[model samples]
Target chain A: MATEIVFYDIPSSLPNKAWSPNTLKTRYALNYKGLAYKTVWVEYPDIESVCRQIGAAPTRNKPDGRPHFTLPMIHDPSTGATIADSAKIAAYVDATYPDRPSLMPAGTVGLHRAFEDAAHPLIGPIYPYCLPASHALLNPVSAAYFRRTREELWGKTLENLTPAGDADRVEWKKLEDGFGKMDEWIRASGEGSKYLMGDVLCYADMWMAAYLLWLKLVLPGRWGEIASWHGGRWGTLLQNLEKYETVL
Target chain B: MATEIVFYDIPSSLPNKAWSPNTLKTRYALNYKGLAYKTVWVEYPDIESVCRQIGAAPTRNKPDGRPHFTLPMIHDPSTGATIADSAKIAAYVDATYPDRPSLMPAGTVGLHRAFEDAAHPLIGPIYPYCLPASHALLNPVSAAYFRRTREELWGKTLENLTPAGDADRVEWKKLEDGFGKMDEWIRASGEGSKYLMGDVLCYADMWMAAYLLWLKLVLPGRWGEIASWHGGRWGTLLQNLEKYETVL
Candidate 1:
């Protein structure tokens, strides 16, 4: 019997697909491990219910008496475990399916560590783009979707994640700076190897590919310099994932 | 014969013992694998020369006219590979010594993913505290010897990291909020297991323990709530590192 896995999705939330680096990291792990799982497209408001059903809900009460809501929580039916936090979920999946292609390398702890370091900062800057108040400023469609999603899902105005009138340009700049750092790392390392871990795909590639896709989607023209710096491997990696785009 | 590993340390500009969760993770892997390595301590301001010896310097035009300087880079004699990122170094160590107790759990990619997520946010807040500008504010010395030792090791300022200011409070709050979320996760998950990943210690525990120690040293009273939430397991973990206190 196949193991049952359920991935909770929210279309407008970057944590939805824009958080793709992490999502794809997990997805690739599942594929590599040859695991079959179901995907549940969830509306934002319903995320809390979904969390409770999976037992990954935080043990705190929301104002509406539901568990504190977060997304990308996965429920594993076979083990009767619901894990939240993407990395934890990924680790659990990797551990349970030892026979599958490893998301991590066989014996190189340093490579694994580099992969982690590479993956961590990728998500830092993209987080603010998800908030309704924050999203509205970046693009109208996102704002409308966030507002509608907020009303439909939470029955209220989206809480201001950033205080009113506070410009996020500084944070965005830091993110850009981080991407520049990444670009340099890629140029330095990718010059000699086919992959970040050298000669093979590993967690680092999955992470960079996913985030690059997300950045391309959200920031569009802005990523050209860094994207170009990736020297085609980054684009090819994403192209390979077109089959998985529906899930993403 | 024991595998030869060399750790380059700078007294003042040392990677914050706390920031070096990956380092500790690697060190623990080394201990678990029973690998023997020598340590070379270099004084700050002259760390560029050491970085050059390994050919892992980050930029061109170092004090030694080689390139940019970064620390905690390692040279693995067994593989004849020079690696700079601490996480990568740790992963390499684990891979190099697969026969011993694994730093990574067998067949678990998710575990590694979880460890990265847990450790990523730690750098933002803890970094400022370790900088010379913030050192007096965060770590007023017991006096001459202690102060001198810290100055000699960590350097008077951070070169690679950008200087932080009051504006970073927003990020600091985010980091604090993250701990709240973690505290809740621990309380909910601690029901059946002694560690985050179940019975045995894994990278998650090591990452958290190391971050908590840094928080204790740098942030002091600020992390009391989270520290208390962790209770005895947290304290015992720090106590185990008594020998590495200075290096940390």
Candidate 2:
């Protein structure tokens, strides 16, 4: 029997940015493995209710309460297990359906480590750095809705969560500095390789693709030039999502 | 026959900080697998000789040469392949020697994902934020020595890498914010288990242990206290390292 999966989604928000990466990753893994599953996209503010159904959110009744109430929570009805954390969700989807082609390669620690290094930078400050700037441009109604949802999930105001005062300026500079580092890495990687892991499209490509998607939305001006350069390397990676969209 | 592995190291320096984590991880894997190899600790600022041998550094003849000139580059003499990047090195060690007790677990993706998430915040601004402050505190002679070694390896000054501008302050704030988020993760992860993976140790524990060691050295006072608190719970996860100290 096919496993049933529910993916809580927000209509239009940055936290949804976190989900998009894993949603695409999970969908890719499912399709690669040739497994079948269903997805449920919950609206913002109401995701709390969906989380309750899966027992992944903090609750007075449950013995242990999780720290935050973020979305991209996955509920496996078949096993009655609810998992949070995007990468964890991707791994769960891959492991539960092992008969399919493995998204993670066998006997390749270098591959796994590369994925870890690439994924970590995106998850830490990079995603958070992009959020406020992207959200600032939203219409007042959408912005208010976004802020309210963020507060509920993070248990703090978005302003407090962001790099404030001098810190904010420094983070922007660091982001700019990172572009040079990325450029250096691309040049060193050489032109012939199809993916970061050579020929096979691994998690590194998926992560870079997801970040590029968010970058495109949040920093369209910068991303437009980046997208055009290198003869559409970033564009090709973004379009690869078609392979994983079925799981979504 | 065991695979031949060579690690380039410096006795005392911060860039050498990269070596410790990679060494610790590879050492544990070697001990777990009962593999044997050679250990060579090169003097600081003198690794240029070693880099020249491996074709990793720049010389007058080749100013912009090789992928990276960073310390702790590994040469797999047997395979005639050279690999850098600490995480990638660890993975290669594990994959090349399959008979070892797996640093990662089978049938679990949550464990692997948790390890990646936990390790990411450490390497980003968290560790880099401490550099300038440490450099400022050191005496001129010592600071000069430290800066020289950095320039030799990275081909850039630390000041240029992390400027004293407003942008640097923002990076610090982002790191400080990360400390809070990590604390929350530690508190919330107390969900009826001691380790992140629960019941048994995994790669997450090893990665955290290695980071804790670096934190103790760089941000000694506060990070030491935090490390002790979490270290108490995860200490056993690292006990296996005692047998692998020779390689480290």
Candidate 3:
């Protein structure tokens, strides 16, 4: 009656072979929901080709307005569904496996979806800090591919993506400043809350924890600084979700 | 039996005598909940003195870091509780009146709260477009107080707060650009949802509608232009909540 759900992720030289925040969002969702899924690591260069081979649709358009395929995509054999995009993957699994624990509960589908959009300001600027380190953590093929694509996108070398010395401090400070605004929102969840919504750990939590996981993995040495930034709020968030960090 | 809640609002020369976006947040919340409340008009200068007289706490601090009193405060004689700040007022009412319809629902308190934080980029830039018009809409005493305090805040005269001619179009375009991001978020609320949250309207809807109401009242003619942005998305939001536009 049950079949393994295949999750497509980007492989890394790092431990557990998962370094992408986007893919981890779906990974966390599956683990949280107690769903059985196997990780299929696709290198950066092979993502589009692999997705095309699987008939997975592109999530969004690139700068030139051409369709761009992304991961955290899932192919569920139980439902015979192939869902692309992390949010869509989560939604698909949740809908397909209604008997399991829900990542997005009833009436919360839209709220958690909005959470991604709402969090863009804080999450968007984090790429520069992690980009160079991420490249270093990748295998040669994916590393070259990541560097080439990201450089073309950002129009700067990965080393120069973040300035060295005190300017880096200023950049990190700007990124750190984004946490306070988010802290206020979390605090508004009735005194002390670590999750995005109150009590129930929804997909929004996965969205956050996945990003923090990427930070923890890619910037292992400096991740503590970010986690400790907002009164240990970010750190506490990751620690609470440690149970769902299983790589399976 | 329920005693009438006293809802404090800023008075304007415009019809219905309500024009402040901040105060309208509470107004819309109270009306949407079907709470029996009477509006008590407060002139701009009297906000501090009146709030102090009624023992309502200051919502936030002013530029000098001193406590700043504001309207949209509420006095619930039934519980002898005085609540300041629109968000606080909504939460208090929801908790106090469990029998009444809820504004900020049980789990959504945080997400909707984040919605406010997330929407600031769009909503914060809108002040300049309404400031001069808001000053014109207020009574003379309040007009003088508003212009004086606002100019002091911006370090520019009310007339200089916004540019005229083609440059004004540039400014308006910048403001309009903000709506697209929000549109993407709102559109994520399932297919063609007019409210911030799908299915059940929440306080987040009040947050948006209240601001739109202020724009409608203060900038009547030009308000339609704002509503028409994002493919009449905002206009539909205000339209869906028209029943709650009652001023009692």
Candidate 4:
């Protein structure tokens, strides 16, 4: 029997919200593997209880001494296996569905991890730049929850945290430079090498695609420019994966 | 008859010199692939002429209009083919000797290229810190050539180009932080993943191993601490590739 994978994600306030980058990574991986899976939408506040109710493994303890919870968790009904963490979930999908496409690829887990490690930092500094737009996308309750939690984490109000006017431009330039280097990397891999892993859609592509997708959803007006940067490399890479966009 | 690969390298003044990281990459690839290869040592001045005579393709011209010639070029006697550029040479090695061990894992050329692109920059800023020690190891003739060319390239004299005292320490911290991220990446890949590509060796491992080897070669007295950074992670990765250090 085909395993019915239950994918979990945080729902934004928007009527037809896209998956967060973290959730999109797992969702994309499942789609790439051609697995039969269904989404289980969870509100931001209920993530902990839902995950715990489903018996998902706790990631780590937070500062408050409570077990940390995260989205993009999965439950495989056939095996009765539950996996949390996007990376681990991808690994599980690869392992369980041996006949499906491998997300990490054979003997590339370290490089894949390193690639992710390297890419995340480059993309991280830009998150605060999108704060205003991101905050607007969240539902009222979730927005309040996000603000309270993020303010505590960032130690700044969202208004003060988000770069304003000219500062925002500088931040965008920094992000562009980071993405530009990655674009050059993709091009230099080999002649006509399109995807991050070269000519094939792999997990790394999904990671970047998810990030780009989030940008598209949160900062609609800015997406055009960001996509156009690097000779439309980022946009085309995302476009190429249209076939793999299964869950909304 | 097996093809004999002619490995090109810049000769240093030191008696027991190792190939530069650029050259070591290809050399390591040849060794890893178990290919039969012999070193062809060329002085800095003769690099252009030797490569041209061997029919290797020319790199782009420098701003000063001098045609750039680089090492780690290879001549395959059996095919009468000469290839320049370490990345290209590695790719050639993988293709020509398909039955042997692959330098880049299958379906990972782009990610491998990207990983390399990301890594090299992290290690690049450390080059200036090693300048004084590097110049000391070069032959007088090559040192003169290196100084003139690098000064023109860097717009600073070799002595002044090298980071001094406090600047050097800051550079070291930057390098450590870069490598620390990479170490976290390696650990996060899986529970027991040791090498850059996870457990098994690949081109990325060779790239890092080559860089670490260069630090050891150029700064003999100082390589100890740098290798021991990140809780001996760098040392462990280099040690893991002990079997692949064949071309020296």
**Interface Cα RMSD in Å, per prediction:** 9.9, 10.7, 2.1, 2.4
Candidate 2 off by > 4 Å: A1-6, A12-41, A53-68, A74-77, A80-85, A103-144, A147-204, A215-223, A229-231, A246-248, B1-239
User: Over the full model, what C-alpha lDDT does candidate 2 score relative to the true structure?
Assistant: 0.54
By TM-score, who's the top model here?
A: 3
Candidate 4 iRMSD in angstroms: 2.4
Per-residue lDDT of candidate 3, residues B213-242 (tens digit): 877877788877888888898788888888
lDDT string for model 4 (B126-194, tens) is 678666567777888888888887778788887787676898788778888877767766775667777
Relative to the true structure, candidate 3 reaches a TM of 0.92
How far out, in Å, is residue A190 in model 2? 9.6
Q: Against the true structure, what is each candidate's TM-score?
A: 0.51, 0.53, 0.92, 0.81
- Identify the superior model by TM-score, candidate 1 or candidate 3: 3
Model 4: DockQ score: 0.45
Query: Model 2, residue B141: what's the lDDT?
Result: 57
- Arranged by TM-score with the best first, the candidates are 3, 4, 2, 1
Give the whole-model CA lDDT for all candidates, comma-separated. 0.55, 0.54, 0.82, 0.79
Give the C-alpha miss distance for residue A67 in model 3, angstroms.
2.6
Which tens-of-lDDT digit does each residue in A145-210 have in candidate 1? 557755666555656443233456676666666655554444434345555444555555666666
- Give the Å error, residue B1, model 3: 12
State how far residue A137 of model 3 sits from its true place (Å).
1.5
lDDT ranking, high to low: 3, 4, 1, 2
Flag clash pairs in model 4.
A13-A139, B13-B139
RMSD of 3: 2.5
